[model samples]
Target: MLQTSPRCSLYLVTPLLSAAAANAFGEIFAEALEAAPVACALVRFVSGSEAHAAAIVAPLLRPARSADCALLIENDVRAAARLGADGVHVAGAGEDLAEAIKRLKPDRIVGAGSLSTRDEAMTAGEMGADYVMFGEPRGGAQTTGLASLVSLTERVAWWAEVFETPCVAFAQTIEAAGTLADAGADFVALGDAVWAASSPAAAVRDAQSVITRAGVGVP
Candidate 1:
């Protein structure tokens, strides 16, 4: 199997909070990212550019030569490559993921998102998904919020046990992120929980502390 470098200190999912959440979200995310001292900072972090979100975020990030950035889309793997994102997250709900992988080749890190189904997990693994992102895909139909959480997380667990693809678990809040680490998630995805904070630096520290307290080793 192919190897992924490993997880970073802050894995941030972008475009958080509609208008209300957007006001300061970007600044907070950048602030938190910078505060996580580069001396001990393991990595630059991960961001999802579903639509043209990458264009908006890329400028804000202006990632260093060493920074790591991923663009997670509903299905467009090619767009990710075009944008020069470090990785691409493909959802199982889309068309055959293998085809997407073929289009992307060895450049983009391909990850498949799941909501916890055995078949879906196996299919992703068989398709050679570089990483398996288990956790409910957030910010879609609002009604599915609560249910998507457990379903996605459980599937992440299953994928880890059954597939070669490593898993990243998404948590709605910092506390929940810690829970995911406890559950053995390889990497924890933090959305607005930390990004929307008044002090993104403090938020990163809070989440990292919780992750450490939960006994999950950071890469």
Candidate 2:
């Protein structure tokens, strides 16, 4: 589970990486972490066997831990266990999530994403997900535009108002981080908004500024 924070925090999500890219990204990730207080980071890899994925993820462990950032593996529980990642993030709120929780609970964080409805989100919370993410693009697609952002903000507002379980809201751009924070998300996830920037670390600083500004009087 995420540590409680009085204000919304940053959650970093890497672009899908290959083993060769992981080493370079490790440097970039460390730079971004220095820009602000990130609550956690989820590392996604290009399709590969679990052992291969674990090999790709291994080099990142030290950087993440040195920064006190919880590192999460996307969708592979076995790799996460093998690499001793801080947690695993299951893409759907179903048996995958349930099994992840059953296998790793009390020792690892299991977050749920790809929820399409209130019912699914509720089910994930009931099953003890460490956090439920909203607004993440499905299947490596580009970020959906304004309509999805509006819907995401609304869902985040509703969840913050009604639920005790922590919520993570994906922000497609640095500016959107503020909107989600104001909507009461406990953490705002940054993907393309950070990694696509010319200076990923600078983008992270900008995002932290926006979230801080939005958090004033947010309660």
Best by lDDT: 2
Residues 1-219 of candidate 2: C-alpha lDDT, one tens digit per residue: 777598899999988888888889888998999888898999998866454785678778888888899999999898888788989999778889989999999799999988878888999999999999987844445333324678889999999999999999998889888999999999999998899899999999999999998957643
Query: What TM-score would candidate 1 get against the native?
Result: 0.71
Give candidate 2 misplaced runs (Cα > 4 Å).
138-147, 217-219
lDDT of 2 at 169: 93
Q: In candidate 2, what residue range of length 10 has the lowest lDDT sum? A: 138-147
**lDDT value for model 1:** 0.55
The C-alpha lDDT values of all candidates are: 0.55, 0.87
Every model's Cα RMSD, please?
Answer: 5.8, 2.4
| Residue 137, model 2: Cα distance from true site in angstroms | 3.6
